[model samples]
Target: MRIQVSRQLLDRQLVDVDGRLVGKVDDVEFALDADGVPYLRTLLTGPGALGLRVGGRIGRMLVLTAERFVTDRPMVPLRIPYGLVDRVDSAVWLRIRAEQLPTSPVEEWLRRHLIGRIPGAGRAGG
Candidate 1:
């Protein structure tokens, strides 16, 4: 199937099989076959990818802001293989569940430093 990367893929929300929010398609990875035909290899998500795709001062700030949360010098983005994508409709549907994916460092940081400090934050539903 033919796809318009910018129009259909980029900035689209990624939804797992369970309908859980995964992330957005911030950037993409491409590879060339033996025949020299380029193909989309991976879908990258997270601030790192978004920042790079955006580029310039605002982009650097975006990444720097997220980097402050994690001890890692350069934050790693969640890379979803194109093969793992079951479909791409209104949103990109994944063949796996969100639990199968690694937790975002930014999210984890917020949970530990901010959200976890909130009263009753540990409890689901009020």
Candidate 2:
């Protein structure tokens, strides 16, 4: 299907099959086919991609803040193959569930070190 990347894909919210918020379409990857045709390879999401897209001082701050939680120097974005997309409407729906996708490194780090440490973090709130 033909789609206007900037209008229909970029900045669109990404959802899993079960309607869970995966992330936004922070950026996209393109690859060339054997026939020299260009095609969308993956949908990149997470702070890293967003920071890069944003660019400049504020962007650097974003990346640095997220990096503090992890030992890794550069965080990697969550990459969802374009083929995994089930449909595109107000959001891009994935054929698989969120659990099927890899968790963002920064998010994982934060959850383990920060969020997980808060009082009553293990309990459900009313």
Candidate 3:
């Protein structure tokens, strides 16, 4: 589909069919074919990939912050293969629900150690 890369694509949140948030578009992956032609391979997200794309001090700080959350020194980006994408409009839609995919370690940690500890944290705010 013909889409305005910046407006219709970038920075938009990706959600699964069931309405679970996957992530935002941090970067797009590309693949080269036999003719040396490149095509969109996947959508990359998470603080690590986004930090590098953002660049400079701010980006480095973001990466470092994310790294501190996990035992690993470097945080890894989440990859959503292009084939799994169902459509693109105001936001990207995925064919499957987010629970099917691996959960972000940072998110799990926060929910368990931080958010879960607070009263009414389980409830969503309007």
Native RMSD of candidate 1 (Å): 1.4
**Candidate 2 ranges beyond 4 A from true positions:** 118-126
Instruction: Order the candidate numbers by lDDT, best to worst.
Output: 1, 2, 3
lDDT of each: 0.95, 0.91, 0.87
Model 2: weakest 10-residue lDDT segment is: 66-75
Clashes of 3: 0
What lDDT does candidate 2 reach at residue 65? 89
Return whichever of 1 and 2 wins on lDDT.
Answer: 1
Per-residue lDDT tens digits of candidate 3, residues 84-108? 9899977899999999887887898
* Candidate 2 residue 13 C-alpha distance from true site, Å: 0.8
Relative to the unseen true structure, what is the C-alpha lDDT of residue 26 in candidate 2, on a scale of 0 to 100? Answer: 96
Estimate, for each residue in 1-126, the C-alpha lDDT of model 2 and write its tens digit.
Answer: 999999999999999999989999999999999999999999999888999999999998998888877677788888899999999999999999999898777678778889999998889786
Best by TM-score: 1
Q: Which digits, one per residue and each the tens of the lDDT, describe model 1 over residues 29-95?
A: 9999899999999999999999999999999999999999889779888999999999999999999
Candidate 3 TM-score, C-alpha based: 0.88
The pairs that clash in candidate 1 are: none
